[model samples]
Structures are given as C-alpha cells and as structure tokens.
Target: MDFKTVSTIGLESSPVAQALAGLRANEARYFWNKYKHEFVTEPAANNPAIVARVNTILGERDTHFETAPLEVSDFEVAGVR
Candidate 1:
C-alpha cells in the first residue's frame, strides 16, 4: 500500500519557536506511524482492533503542542487525476 500526506501550517513565535517547531514535527511523525495502519491496509474500511492498537501506541508517546491543525486524507484507489 502507498499513502501520500501533505501538511501546511502557520506558526507564531513566542521565544522558543524553533524548538517547539521541532517538537511538533516529531509528534506529527509519531502520530503518523501510529495511525498509518488505516492507510497501509487493503480494502479500505474501519477496524476497531486497528484503531485500538494505534491509540495504544500513541498513548506511550509524551508530547504536547500548544496549537496545531491536523488533517488525514484517505484515497483507497489511486489513478490518474
């Protein structure tokens, strides 16, 4: 399975803006892998077990974001646009 993701956001600086940005990217990756099962499986559908597993994995990560927008797009069948 193949998945493509795109993210766009605007950030406001307080003092440690760069550090916070790095932290945010790390968290994004963390959540990306945690919730990637839905994108990696065939026959797109919701699986409670898979979601539970994702939640479990994310629960182990300790990260915080002041304010950030997130988006998750799904496209099961990919062909010519």
Candidate 2:
C-alpha cells in the first residue's frame, strides 16, 4: 500500500503543528502496518463536503464553536463514504 502525507497548510506557523504532525504520522503508520492502506488528508478549505457534514452534525445538536478547522481528513475503505 502507498502512504500519503497529511496536509498541514495553514498550520505551518502554529505552535501545535509539530505535535499534530506527529499524531498524523502515528496514525498513518498504524494504518499502514495493520491494514496496509494509506492514510491521507487534505486542507479543510479544499474539502467542502466534509466541512458541510461536520457543520450539519453540529447544527443537529445545536452546538456552536468558534474555531474553524484548518485541515480535514476522511477515512474510507471498500468504497465506503
């Protein structure tokens, strides 16, 4: 299986980028070792569907948050969405 790197665009200047990158690397490593599949990610700005879904779910629960996500990831296998 091929491994894909996670996207951390706007997070470059963030103090937490290192930690987040480590976490993403760990997740990718786990998936590669166990399922032999790649873990991929993209900037949230590039994935409108995911952002809409997340906001919809939050709206359903009447929950509101101020911070918007800078990156997004979707995990899928066997044609599942």
Assess each prediction's global lDDT (C-alpha) against the native.
0.40, 0.74
- In candidate 1, the residue pairs with backbone N, CA or C atoms under 3 Å apart (3 or more residues apart, or in different chains) clash, namely none
Provide the lowest-lDDT 10-residue window in model 2.
1-10
Clashing pairs in 2: none
Candidate 1 residue-wise lDDT, 1-81, digit = tens: 222332223224335545545555555565458654333222113444554444566667853445322222233333411
Candidates' RMSD to native: 11.4, 3.8
lDDT of 2 by residue, 1-81 (tens): 122555455568666886777677788887778777777777888999999998999999999878787677787766655
Candidate with top TM-score is: 2
- List the candidates' TM-scores in order: 0.32, 0.64
